[model samples]
Structures are given as C-alpha cells and as structure tokens.
Target: MNLDWNFFEEHFPLAVSSLKNARSAGRLTHAFLLCSSNAEYRTAFPPLLASLAACEHPNEDFSPCGRCAVCREMAEGTFPDLITLAPSSLSRIIPIGESEDEVDSMRWFESLFYLSGMTESGWKIGIIHEADRMNEAAQNAFLKTLEEPPPKCMFILTTSHPAELLPTIRSRCQTIQLTDNRCKYSFPNSETLLPILHKLAFESKGSLLTAEDCATALIEFAETLGEEAEKTVAEKWAPRLAESENLESAGKALIEKRIKGEESCEYRRLRDLFLSMIHAYFAQLALLVSNTPAELLPNPELFEHSIRQNEAEEFGADRAFRCLAYAEDLLRAMRTNANDQLAIRAFCLKIAFK
Candidate 1:
C-alpha cells in the first residue's frame, strides 16, 4: 500500500490505466483475481486497487488524491468499509469458521455487504490475500458473495496459483495477470546446484535423467534443509528446552512441540521453494520452445542466459508440456501429508525419458 507512485508510473502504467478506465467507464467488475507470483501482488496491489475504487476525489490520472477523506481513511487503515482477510496465527489454512472472534471472516464479510458504506463514495472493498489458502469449505462459502455481489462493493482475491482455485470461483471474476518483473529469482545459489538441476532436467540423448538420482538429490536437499531448520530452531529455543529444571512436564512438552512444528514448517517451505523453482524452469523451457521474447517470460534474463532454449525443443513440445503438468501435479501432491520422495522420483524418471 506504500508503493511509490513513480514505480507504478514506470512499470505498471497499463494496470493503473485499466483501473482508472474501468472506474471512469462505470464498468468495473464486482470480483477480480489479481494474479501474480510475487508476494507484493497479494500484499500491496489489492489495497492500492481498493483505495483507487473507494476514493471519490482523484487527479486527472485517476490516482487517489491523498487529501481526500476516503484516501486518508484508507491510508490510516481505519476505514470500516474496507474489509481484509488472511490466514491467522492459529492456522495457516483459511477456513469458513470465525477466527477467534464471534463472527468469522466469511460471516463478517457477508454482514458488511448488507450494510451501507461509511464513506460518501459508498464503496465496500474486500481484499483477500493468499486467497488460494482457503479450503474447499471456505471456497464454497465464498460462492455466495461471488454469485450476487452487492452494489458498489468489490472483492479482490490475490493468489500465486490461480489454477488451484475452484473453476466456478475463477469464472465469476475478471483475472488480471500482474507482472512482477521487479522480481529476479536466481535458481541454485551456487553454480554447483544449477548444473545438477539442469542435468537432471535436460541431460542429452543417451544420458537421460533418471528418477532415482533426481529423487535422491531432492530427498537429500530436503533433509539438509530440515536439519538446518532444526539447528536454527534448537538454538532459538535453547533456553526453553534447557530450562526443564524449573519447567513442568506440560510446559516442556509444549516447547518441544513448538520446536518440532517450526522445524517441519521450515522444511516444507524449503521443499516448496525448490519445487516452485523447478516448475518455473520447466515453464521457461516451454517459453523457449515457442521462441518467446525474453521480456515476456518470467525471470526474463535468467532463462535466456542460463537455460538453453534449443535443449527444451529437443525434449519435444508435447513432452515439455507433459513434464510441466507432471511438475505441477507433484507440487500439488506434496501439499498433502504423503511422502513426496517417491513422487519426485517417479516424476523425474518419467520426464527423463518421456
């Protein structure tokens, strides 16, 4: 929400223009999916868009005039009209039930629609960050809001993986692909790791990438990450863990559980990061096969310099798409409690030859 106007002026003129045009035309949609991979798309962009829609006073460019009552309230984040929801501390997953309050997010959100906005502009904006974290029940409950959105109210759902969302939910909204060119993700921090990933992905004719080796590497990486996380967590909680002399069994058990949970979360986060990078590499490979311009692809310059586009072509278009699909499937599968080492190996072995 604290974005420099100059940054938008340079990188996202089209996006800003579209928002302004929709407002002027009086044809803004009730629901929108602001999709992007970068975390900013969820955290910052929605509030910016919401402020734009809710503000009545604006300059010629249609940017919100900071002096306006609505703009000031939005900036203060004390605006009753704007509702925001995200995962709570109790659970990372977004569910339908209340979040420690009497009324849950879904209930509160619904109740707001019935009431009129506090502002003169009469805009009720709801921004859901990491919206895809909503479970099936929450997503289903959200259909009611999408089905018949109230007048002068807009809901913006932001997520990195729009495909994971329900089809019905997706159909109800206008999806805007917000580019994050500012983000430059370099894979395999050390040159050593990059070659390993590439070789496992695109090793030549006779030297096919094997499932066992890929799986082994992935498992090893995951284990190393997990061990590192444990060490960090152990160091952080050393006082608590070692202060068992005065602590009761229940208190000590709780501390131990917290440490384990933190370690597990860190491990999963690391695994997810690696999987996402692999998925991105495959996506870049597909773009290369189609001869997409560097600017058009994610990680713009990284792929051009690091990945050989012709190598992807040699892998075959159908195969590339298939591998991409497999990678996605693997990522989704890993979300569950299932052991992913076998899954990773299976996917790698198939892609190695296929």
Candidate 2:
C-alpha cells in the first residue's frame, strides 16, 4: 500500500482533501490530532499525513510523490526531521529517568524542539502514536513542548480514544475525526453469507479487517469444536453416560483446565476471534429472516428451527443484534484487564441461550 495516498483514499478522503487544501493555501496547522476508533487506521494514517506535510514535491492535490527522497525516507521510517514516540520498547509505559544523567538525556532529546529547523526544507514533524497511553509524567513533560510549539514544526498526535487524552493537550491542536468506511467484499453465489459477514464486520467496530480475520478464525474454530463435540457425543458420552460419576469427574477436570489456561494466557486474540464469529453468526440469522434460502447459509442446522418457525423477524434478527452488543462489551472489558475466562464464558452462555 502506498500508505501516503491509497490508504487515506479509502477511509478518510474528505480529510485528505482538506489536507490538500491546507497545503495549497499554505495554512497547514502546526499541530493535528487524528482521532479514530480503528487502531490499525489510527496507526497507519499519521505517517501518510506526515509524508504529505514533508513531501518535497507536495502538489496541490495533497498527495506525496513516492519517488522523492523525502517521501522515500518517510516511508522507510528513516526521515531525519521526523520523530515518533509511543510507550517505550523495553517497558510498556514511557520511561522516566531517576538519575541526573538519565534525566539530562531525556531532556536533551526533548530539547530537540528548541533547535533551529535542521532539514533543508526547514520543516520538522513529530508523531506520537497512542498519545493517550502516555503516563501522567510523560503527558506533563510533553505539555510544555506542545504549548510552545517551535517554528516550522508540526506535531501529529494519533489516538484511538481521543477522550482519554488530557483536555489541555487536546485543546492545543486541530482535531480531525476519521471514521471507518464500510469495506466492500464480493462473494460468488454465496449471498446467503453476505449478511452474516456484514454483521460481523459491523460488530468488529469499524474494523472490517479484524472482522474478516475473525470470520476465518471462527469458521475454523467452529469446525473443530463441532467435530470434537460429535465425536464425544457418539463415542465418549455413550460409554460414559452409563457411568455418571466418571462423566461428571471428567467434565469438571476439563472445564477447570480450560479456565486455568485462559487465565494465564492473554486471551485477547481468542476473544477477538470469538467476537467475530458471533457477529457472523448473527448476521447470518438476520439474512435468514430476510428470506435468504436455507441451503445458502453456513451452519444451516443452527438456523433451521428459527427459519421453519417463521419467527426470523421477531426472534432471529433482534437476538443477533443483542449478541453483537454483548460481544463488543466483552471485548472492551477484556482490553481493560477484566477476567478473561469469565468474560468469554459469559459471552458464550449468552449466545448459547439466545
């Protein structure tokens, strides 16, 4: 992807057009806050915007010429006049030095703001990704720099959740909201799957990319789980049901193990996959209600009863939407350090009953 132009063309054409106008008018602001909910877009858009500002051959169109030395450097992440920051690599939080020498080093890097513009173009650009993740001290440290922005310098702050940012800092910059565009996908005679897929994409909270990944993972996981469940019901359950105590003991052990493993391993990836699956499942239900033929649906057995009962509108569509909302809430809680097993189990229970 020519991150500078192609990506922006898809999600934020209006913002890109505005940027072009600003560049043409020579009225580009010294600071910009690119606010968005999609982390992938949030991370990618700033560099593209930075390239636009720093491009050697910035035309009136606001697009950067990828062949130019400045654009190439920015794309390669080696541009001298551009700086970026996030939580430190070694530590999950921005590093704060305790010793005098350490503080001096930090201050020296911070003082780069005070220096005269070093590049021949006389423009310096700084990008801070996850600006909301900065700790109190780091925020305070950057506050002075943001308030007294240097000449010929521009700061671009990218954040997924702009509300988390400090009000004082946010007030200093021009804010631009980047909303996700609905991604278009084509399916061959598989129109039955389209509604389900669309629902999943929407549940992904504007990240169609995440929704696609989730859908693939869900299909794989569901296949594996279904096969396992069938095998257990046929071979294991039939033999063990006669011995009820043995079945109970085995089930308890298995549940305990899964819960323990979930607690130790970060389940963000799995939670995302599961949520995507739920979205797809509900979307399919909605389509079924809308008269999508049964044979075209994935897991037709799952929707057979609802379809035959003619309760698709009253039951299927509404239930699917409710499940989608639940999945989003679970995802949010999981990101905030909530108990993974409990969250996953709660979501599963809801879906199973619904």
TM of each candidate vs. truth: 0.56, 0.57
Q: What would the TM-score be for candidate 1 when compared with the true structure? A: 0.56
Please list all clashing residue pairs in model 1, or write none if there are none: 98-104
Candidate of highest TM-score: 2
For each of the candidates, give the backbone clash count: 1, 2
For model 2, the stretches where C-alpha displacement exceeds 4 angstroms are: 1-3, 6-13, 60-62, 88-119, 183-318, 338-346
Give per-residue CA lDDT, model 1, range 202-297, as digits (tens): 662234435566668766765576676677667766765677658888867755655664465445444455666767777776776777766788
Query: Which lDDT values do the candidates have, in the order given?
Result: 0.67, 0.58
The candidate that wins on lDDT is: 1
In model 2, the Cα lDDT at residue 150 comes to 78
What TM-score does structure 2 among the candidates reach?
0.57
